[model samples]
Target: MSYAPQKRHSNRAKRWIITIGVFIVVQIIFIAIDGTFLEPSINDSDNVLAKTVRGVLESKLLTERIAPYSFPFFNLFLIVHVVAILIQALGDSISAIFAKR
Candidate 1:
């Protein structure tokens, strides 16, 4: 008769919200740092990884049109976030399949 289960579910949802908010804030900070300091210095560098990253940034279609002032690292963060979501979904699906047995 207790509402403990409902309360626990609500708590879990709140935790997820807070965690996601923190993740977004961290990404914003990363983008700022990369744009304000890292990218400018690396722009003229001969590093292969930096060149690859610059190429990837140049290849973004929607991001550039949507936000002209967006940082280069913003696209990278989005890609990473999407991949993380996909991996989490896959893990959840595998766990569900195993749980059914």
Candidate 2:
């Protein structure tokens, strides 16, 4: 019954989209710089997820020769952030879809 609350929530989601857009633009700039001027590579990543992945790989029986590749940490960070933002937008969109019924 309270439509005002829904309106406020819409504005919040819109703000989130805008913020994410800005971040995406910044990421594009960084990627451009990285590609055009410098060599981008993560030689030693301290990320917990990456460490876990390495652990799993090492634990596997036939993964001896299949070395753990260098994780593109910065690229992964950019990608995961973008994906998280999209996921938030997706959840909001899904909620709107159900309300339409």
Residues 1-101, model 1: lDDT tens digits: 77775775586568557757877787776657654656543364789987887777767552665343466556566667767766766765675566522
Most accurate candidate by lDDT: 1
Q: Model-by-model lDDT, in order?
A: 0.63, 0.60
Alpha-carbon shift of residue 52 in model 1 (angstroms): 1.3
Across residues 1-101, which tens digit of lDDT does each residue of candidate 2 receive?
76876786788778887877888697666666654436454334898976775565444332433222222434445556667878877987887677653
As for candidate 2, its clashing pairs are: none
- Model 1 scores a C-alpha lDDT of 0.63
**Model 1 spans with C-alpha error above 4 angstroms:** 1-21, 27-43, 62-69
Instruction: Please identify model 2 stretches exceeding 4 Å from their true place.
Output: 1-6, 9-13, 32-71
Residue 9 error, candidate 1, Å = 11
lDDT of 2 at 89: 78
